[model samples]
Target: MGASNFVQEMKEVGERLLLKLQRLPQAEPVEIVAFSAIILFTATVLLLLLIACSCCCSSCCGPAARGRKSQVQPMAPR
Candidate 1:
């Protein structure tokens, strides 16, 4: 009997959630705009950071790009 009661309560809760989900498409417009803006801003910032890192690394590392010796040096064996 207790198990049956619990199952009925769970079914009622699930039904309520289903009703709410059905109305989800009518959410506030401002919320939709804000969410979209956040996504765009995050993507733009990540892309800019990646570009800056590549540029900085190429310049800081040895000139091995063409015909220059890298910063690495060979050690004399003792």
Candidate 2:
């Protein structure tokens, strides 16, 4: 008799748990939109960083860099 009562209690608890889970709301669309926005933002930031690095490196290390080099060089013998 006691064993049957325990089994019945467990079954009731399981049903309640399943009902709560079934009532939970889904968020697939929201998740997809958020993921896409994050990806786009990350890509834009990476592109901007790449462009900035290229501009700085080229202007500071290319032939044109020679123009600024003279300004920083120390004066030599007359």
Candidate 3:
């Protein structure tokens, strides 16, 4: 089944990640620092982009600018 194939692929990916983690301890300090710096830089860039998008024109011109108004009105008794 397709699910079984997806599970097998996930297991393979997990194994590969585990092998990489096991090898991490043997890596040089400089390599670790460089990798850490790269990760932090990527995180910073992504966070800045997210903040910029949230603060842009969409918040001013989009549907969010309008207040919710009720559509129903009270009916008179017959």
- TM-score of every model? 0.45, 0.49, 0.48
Better of 1 and 3 by TM-score: 3
In candidate 3, which residue pairs clash? none
Model 3 lDDT, residue 72, Cα: 94
Q: For candidate 1, lDDT tens digit of each residue in 26-50? A: 8688766775686689899999999
Cα displacement (angstroms), candidate 3, residue 37, comes to: 0.5
List lDDT for all candidates, in order.
0.80, 0.79, 0.82
Q: Write the per-residue lDDT of candidate 3 for residues 16-77, one digit (tens) a residue.
A: 86786687789899877886787699899999999988788677666877655468989999
Residue 35, candidate 2: alpha-carbon lDDT: 56
Highest TM-score against the true fold, candidate: 2
Q: Which ten contiguous residues of candidate 2 have the minimum total lDDT?
A: 20-29
List candidate 2 stretches off by more than 4 Å: 1-27, 67-78
Report clash pairs, candidate 1. none
A best-first ranking of the candidates according to their lDDT comes to 3, 1, 2
Model 1: worst 10 consecutive residues (lDDT sum): 61-70
